[model samples]
Target: MLSNRYFTNGIDIYFDNVCGSMLDAVLNMTNHGRIAVCGMVSQQRLSQPEGIYNLFNLVIKSITMKGFLQSGYLHLFPMFLEDVVRFYKQGKIIYLEDVNEGLESSPIAFAGLFSGRNLGKQVICVARE
Candidate 1:
């Protein structure tokens, strides 16, 4: 549960419900970073949400940011898969995951996810595919 993970390694990819962290992530990103805005969880509750002032960082740093949800893009799944598969084959994309073994580890893995301990997409391997 280290808060400084991004601050230390810098954010190559970022997404947050709140814009404040998004700004921080923008600043913390390495060169050629990407930001994918999935949802704004906290802002949904807040009447006055935060605003990001330093968007120029994206331009200066050559960062890319896009906001979208999977459900909204369900129709484009085939296209997405084709592109992703090609990218993967070309080694243009890197995937990261924190995989935990056993069904018993799920609770801990789930907890780590919320606590920010997981480094990437967290998964509990109840069985092999």
Candidate 2:
């Protein structure tokens, strides 16, 4: 898999939004790694989720994992939005979106987010502006 190939020497930092298999795979390959856990979409629908086996590696590798909620940092939204707008106007940022037309395609588009079928951000357009 990508983790086995890319993390041969281990990673310094990892931004983890998808927890489950990917997180389990990364735990084994972390060397003083700092993991910022934002979401756990992988385990959302599971009644019984798989347990991480290599959690002991955290102690061995001195890894740090922290979870955060964006709602808690609502105060920073203006600053964040400003930076995003600046980057977008300066052509420093690229937005890649898989847009599904109409409400009928919303289910497929939303499901694609978890399946990795969408390349970047997935958007469901009910109407054009």
Candidate 3:
């Protein structure tokens, strides 16, 4: 059982990445909350995704849940890139890259993502451009 202090007032918005127990916990703590379902890394390799016991809370609390895909927003790429470049140039953003030296290391780099072995965005440098 979670402490009352954990959600005494309830959450307004939740950005979900790892779904499963964490999702369940959020569900129980939400009150008319808005949940942005980003990624479900927790259920990626599972044969069957775990069921959420607190799903009924969504109805009870009148929550809003939405899923998004980056590809779906490709039309806004130019705007996104402009903002990112402006931020980067203005020293407002710091980018991190976990780069693998050769094409041979591509598999390892891909696997590292799922295992949390990569520290930053994994990149396989086939040949430096």
Candidate 1: worst 10 consecutive residues by lDDT? Answer: 16-25
Per-residue lDDT tens digits of candidate 1, residues 1-129? Answer: 122553566667765533454445455467798888776643555567666666778889898888887699899999999999999999987656889999999998876654445665788889988
Query: Which scores greater on TM-score, model 2 or model 3?
Result: 2
By lDDT, the better pick of 1 and 2 is: 2
What would the per-residue lDDT of candidate 3 be over residues 6-110, giving only the tens digit for each residue?
546765777776677767877866567899998887679979888888899889989898999777999999999999899999997744588999999999888
Q: Candidate 1: where are CA atoms >4 Å away?
A: 1-27, 40-66, 127-129
Global CA lDDT of candidate 3, please?
0.76
Best by TM-score: 2
Q: Candidate 2 on 1-129: residue-level lDDT in tens? A: 545675566656777766777677778765778889998876787789757787998899899999999899999999999999999999977545789999999998888766445544688899999
Q: Rate the local accuracy (lDDT) of all candidates.
A: 0.68, 0.77, 0.76
Return the candidate ranking by lDDT, descending.
Answer: 2, 3, 1
TM-score of candidate 1 on Cα atoms, chains taken together: 0.57
Better TM-score candidate (1, 3): 1
Error of 3 at 23 (Å): 0.4
TM-score of each: 0.57, 0.61, 0.54
Error in Å for residue 127 of model 3: 30
Alpha-carbon shift of residue 125 in model 2 (angstroms): 15
